[model samples]
Target: MLKTFRISAILEGISYLLLFSFSMPLKYWANITEPNIYIGYVHGFLFIAYIILAVFFAVDKKIAPKKGIMLVLASLLPFGTFYMDRHYLKPLSAS
Candidate 1:
C-alpha cells in the first residue's frame, strides 16, 4: 500500500507538471494553440488515477480524513505533490 501510494504520488506530480508547465504553456505562450490533446488526456487520466490511489492508500493506512484529503489535494497544484513528499510523507531531512 505504501509503495503504491508513493508511486501514484510521483506520477501525479509528473502529470501536474506536464499540464501546467508544458501543455498549458504550449497552448498559450508558445502559441501552439492546439491544446496538445495527448498531454491533456494523459494528465486527466493520471489525475483521476492519483485521486483513486490516494484514497485507497489512506484507507489501507488508516490515515485521518483531513490529512488524507490534504495529501490528495496536493496533486492539484504545480510541485505540490513533491512538497507533500518532502514535508509530510517522508521523514524530514537533517539540515
Candidate 2:
C-alpha cells in the first residue's frame, strides 16, 4: 500500500505539473484547447486516485489524523506531493 501510494503520488505530481505547465500554456498561448481537455481528465482521475490511496494507507498505518490531513492537502499544491513523499512517505517506507 505504501509503495502504491508513493508511485501514485509521483504520477499525480507529474500530471499536475503537466496540466499547468504544458496544457494550460498550450490552451492560453497557442489557442489550443484539446490538450488541456485530455490532460485535465487524466489529472482529475489521478488526483482522485491519489486521495483514495493516501487515505487508505493512512488509515491502515494508523498515521496521525493531522498528518493524514496534510497528506491529502499536499495534493492540492504544485510539487507538494513530491515534497511530502521525500520528507514523509519515503521515511515511513524505509522503516
Candidate 3:
C-alpha cells in the first residue's frame, strides 16, 4: 500500500508540474490549447487518485489526522508532493 501510494504521489506530482509548467504556458502564451485540455484531464484524475490513496494510507497506517491533512494539501502545490514524499512518506515507509 505504501509503495503504491508513493508511486501515485510521484506520478501526481509530475502531472501537476507538467500541467502548470508546460501545458499552461502552451495554452496561454503559445496559443496552443489542446495540450492543456489533455494534461488537465490527466492531472485532475491523478489528483483525485492521490487524495484517495493518501486517505487510505493514512487510515491504514494510523497516521495523525493533521499529517493526513497535510498529505492531501501537498497535492495542491507544485513540487509539494515530492517534498512530502522525501521528508515524510519515505521515512514512514522505511520504518
Candidate 4:
C-alpha cells in the first residue's frame, strides 16, 4: 500500500509540474489548449488518487492528525509530494 501511495505521489507530482510548467504555458502563451486539457484531466485524477490513498494510509497507520493534514496540504504545493515521500511516507514505510 505504501509503495502504491509512493507511486501515486510521484505521478501526481509529475503531472502537476507538467500541467503548471508546460501545459499552462502552451495554453495561454501559444493558444494551444489540447495538452493542457489532457494534462489537467490526468493531474486531476492523480491528485484525487493521492488524496484518497493518503487518507486510507493515514487511517491504517494511525498517523497523527497533524501529519495527516500535512499529507493533504502537501498536494497543493509544487514538489511537496516528493518532500512528503522523503520526509514522511518513506519513514512510515520503513516502520
Measured by TM-score, the strongest candidate is 2
Residue 57, model 4: Cα distance from true site in angstroms = 0.5
Clashes of 4: 0
What's the CA RMSD of model 4 in angstroms? 0.8
Query: TM-scores of the models, in the given order?
Result: 0.82, 0.97, 0.96, 0.96
lDDT of 3 by residue, 1-95 (tens): 98999999999999999999999999999999999999999999999999999999999999999999999999998899999999998997889
The segments of candidate 4 whose C-alpha lies over 4 angstroms from its true place after superposition are none
Tens-place lDDT per residue, model 4, 1-95, is 88999999999999999999999999999999999999999999999999999999899889899989999999999999999999988887888
Of 3 and 4, which scores higher on TM-score? 3
- Record all residue pairs in model 1 with backbone atoms less than 3 Å apart, i.e. clashing: none
Instruction: Report, for all candidates in order, the number of backbone clashes.
Output: 0, 0, 0, 0
Please tell me which predicted candidate would have the highest lDDT against the true structure.
2
lDDT of 3 at 82: 99
Per-model RMSD to reference: 3.3, 0.6, 0.7, 0.8
- Which pairs clash inside model 4? none
Q: lDDT of all the models against the reference?
A: 0.78, 0.97, 0.95, 0.95
Q: Is candidate 1 or candidate 4 better by lDDT?
A: 4
